[model samples]
Target chain A: MSEAVLSIRNLTVEIPTRGGILRPVDQINYDINRGEILGIVGESGAGKSMAGNAVIGLLNRPAKITGGEIWLNGTRIDQLEGEDMRRLRGKHIGMVFQDPLTSLNPLLRIGDQLTETMLEHLDISRDKARKRAAAALDEVGIPAAAQRLDSYPHEFSGGMRQRVVIALALCAEPSLIIADEPTTALDVSVQAQIIALLKRLCRDRGTAVMLITHDMGVIAETADRVAVMYAGRLAELGNVRDVVTHPEHPYTDGLMGSTPLASKGLKRLRQISGSMPRLTAMPEGCAFHPRCEFAQDICRAEPRPKLNGGRSACHFPIQQPAEETA
Target chain B: MAMIQVKNLTRIFDVSKPWLNRVIERLPKAMLTAVSDVSFDVEERTVYSLVGESGSGKSTIGKMAVGLLKPTDGSVLINDIDLSRETDGGKLDKARSDIQMIFQDPYASLNPRWRVREIINEPVSARGGNVVGLAEKLLEQVGLSSLDADKFPHEFSGGQRQRICIARALASEPKLIVCDEPTSALDVSVQAQVLNLMSDLQENLGLTYLFISHDLTVVQHISDKIGVLYLGRLVEEATPDELFENPKHPYSQMLLAAAPKMDGFGREIDPPQGEIPDPINPPTGCAFHPRCPIATAKCSAERPEMRVVRGARVACHLAE
Candidate 1:
């Protein structure tokens, strides 16, 4: 992809705990090109959200980004001051979270929230911002956008509220959007709608997206490229089709096989044995060596393996795709 | 034979404010009909799944099935004994033993203070059954080690806690279990493990399950028969094969279409337009008509009864 909109070079986030220093997001690197959606998928506590938070500078107390650079449009943004980072959030890097109810202010009207963000980001007139908010709402497929803008967040249904949230995110015309589980809270139908809306609006406006989710199906459906994270590290990164259909990492393959697709029939799903290790108890060398089917002695003794072309962290990337193996 | 029979099950929740607040606001008494006239049967040793989004009354129906929540209007029969109408204490106790409930949140379901042994033995101990070695046996049955019986709920992971809950449910030796989104909270891989364990247990022990989940794929995998709910109403019911192959109801079709498929990577999804109508004052006729793609004038005027079409029970006028 040409002209990457968002680039992460060896980003790491560490939290100091009673047990020890917990590295939730270990040195991982990826890029989201202009108008591309990069899916970051992992199980709970795999640091997908932590990575997104580090990018948006929303990490919790004591969980600080320790190493590497976050470049937005060629500008290193990891060390931006508080006010500059806050300004950069709405103007350059908009964020959408899983729950719309929490993201939106229930006391304020949808129009007011949209206009407030727009006015903050862009030096535009109030009338123009209101018109743009209505247009944004319309673009996200909220029916009777102009009138419904006056309604409170509670008045609109869950799906409509998500659409309004998406509109709020898009109203400022951010170059990058970090949508962390944006559709996880919605129904399957509503999830599809929101995903499609996100894809369309982002594509039209050339907005790069960093979609963080645990659902492989969502990543398969919406993502341009996929990054599989395991125990705070990137397990695999490749084209969505290649990574999903032809997974190079054993962990990615396990995820693909575990999903109950209609084509796979009613057979027992391929489950990854044991759960992800807690951050404090993460294994030496490769964090996933304990659960990996292809783990060797080298995996346990060596530092995290870096794959050729930085595509995967597995020491021995599978030559054959998982589908053929299965 | 149907191990569990739900007949016209309805649960109405009074969602209005306090009497004084209501009087001051000039608002009349309000009730939200969470589950309305829902009926289905779980055959002996078969899995019957109820699939729906939130507020579709799926969880309410599940709760009613296991006697956790009493229905406002209808009856849930376990082994042909009416759950709501059972008056005798002895009969109610016997019926309760036959039906066990597995809740959604494993973290909150099990008492944190209680050890796994006590948690699993509660059902057996209540009925004066042999509690000795019961927890150990149940733990082993659910793929956990016997040593785990000594540990507290907080000592285990989310998936392990869910397994403990399953073991506790099984300790009662229930004929039917109402599982309310059993694997939704677990990771995808862990979800598969739990589902596989449940399927294996069902096959080996002839256990019947009234599985409830919003995930279409999980439901499709586990269910022999499936019911699609929309706003407390059953819009479609059919075998998983029949339902997935050809969904008759527009709501069911929309759900199937919107369900994310791994095979369709990079494929653009065309989800149905509109949102779920307000359940308190739902659409004029069909609750799903507002979001349904093939909704007609008749759809908004009169509700369609479940009719047998193409080997499926569908509540849609256009399903021929």
Candidate 2:
């Protein structure tokens, strides 16, 4: 994905636990091309979200990015100071969170919240910012944008409120957008609309999107490529169609098999047994081995061989070795 | 004969400015119709699913089925007994016992402070009927270990908590279970396990299901027949295979299109054209006319009666 908008290399995140530093996101490397939609899919707590948080510098307290280079466009954001990072956040890298209610200021007027971001990041005046905010609302398909601007988050319905969140994120025309489970909270129909809107806007503005979600269907529909994570590591990375239809990692395969599909009717799902182990003490060799039906002794002995230079795409990286042979 | 039947089910909430506020502000009163004129039937021991997007009244129907919510209009009959407080004690008890409800949030629905034993024991205890070692048996029935009866709800993960909820529901030994988005709160991996458990329990126990959810795909996996609801109305009803393979209603078509396809890759089927109509003052005739791609002028003027079209019951002017 060269001509890449964001380049993440050797990205590793750790949490301070009583026992020792626990790696929630092991070293991983990947890049998102301009205007492209990169899907990250895995079961909940698979570290898919951790990767997104790490990229946006939004990792929670007790968590630290131990090593990595996050090059947004040409600038390295990983090491940028507080003010510089803050300035770049809304202006250059927008984010759409899973829960709009939590992300949005409940007490503040929608207009004020939108304007606040522009005011902080842009040199525009209050009037222009307000107008821009209204237009952004309209662009995200919110109706009567001007009148609704003064309303609080609670005043809008779930879907409408989510649209407002998207509008706020889009107002800055950020080069990169990180949407972490953005549609998971909304209804199926509303989710379809939001995903469609995100894709269309990304295409129109040539803005790259990093979609972090567990739903493979969303990724198959909207993503150009997908990077599947498992137990704090990248298990597979390839084209959406290739990865989804012919998943290299056993975890990806299991996920695809497990999900219920619209066309399929009255059939038993192939459930992946056992819960994912806690991040504090992940398995020694391959984190997914505990639940991997195809796991062997080697999978639990040593860490998997790194292939994306630092991306951990299974112990035996699938496509790379095949590509090497070819 | 069907085991449970709902007729013209409607639920209207006083979601308006209060009477005093309305009088002070000179504002007209408004009511929110959570569900309006919905109707359906569940075959004996079969899984009947109500599927729709959020705010489409799927859960409302589920609640009404189990007598958790009283219908604003029409009636719900379980075993030919009306679900009303006025009904005879024996009849009411039978109806209530015949249908048990499982809530959406396992975490919230379950009592965190109570032991799994007490949680399961509440319904059984209330019935004044005894099942020997019922707590242990229920945990085992739901694929949970007998030892699980001692732990608190928080100790288990989201999936296990839901299993406990299922166990609690089954503890009443109900003929039907109204599962309202039972697995929506669970992770995808965990969801599969719960769905499988429900299906297995249904076969082994001969339990009927009134599964309500916004997820069509998940419904497709478990439902024998599916009902499509829009703005609190039963817009379409058909066998799962037939409905999914050849949906006849405009609302069903739009819903199917809007659902994210699981097939490898393709352009999204263009979704329904507009937003969900306001439920209270729903469009003059058909609530979905505003969004129907194939809407006719007649659709806006006259409410179409729900008639069978090519084997599926559909409520649309265009449907034959």
Write model 2 residue lDDT over B107-224, tens digit each, in one string.
8998889999999999988878785699999898888899988899999988989999999999888899989999988878889899989989999999999998888888888998
> Which tens-of-lDDT digit does each residue in B35-67 have in candidate 1?
888887778989999999888999988888877
Show how many residue pairs clash in every candidate, following the order shown: 0, 0
Q: How big is the positional error of residue A215 in model 2, measured in Å on the Cα after superposition?
A: 1.3
Error of 1 at A173 (Å): 1.2
DockQ, prediction 2? 0.61
Compute DockQ for each candidate against the true complex: 0.76, 0.61
Span of ten consecutive residues with least summed lDDT in model 2 chain B: B264-273
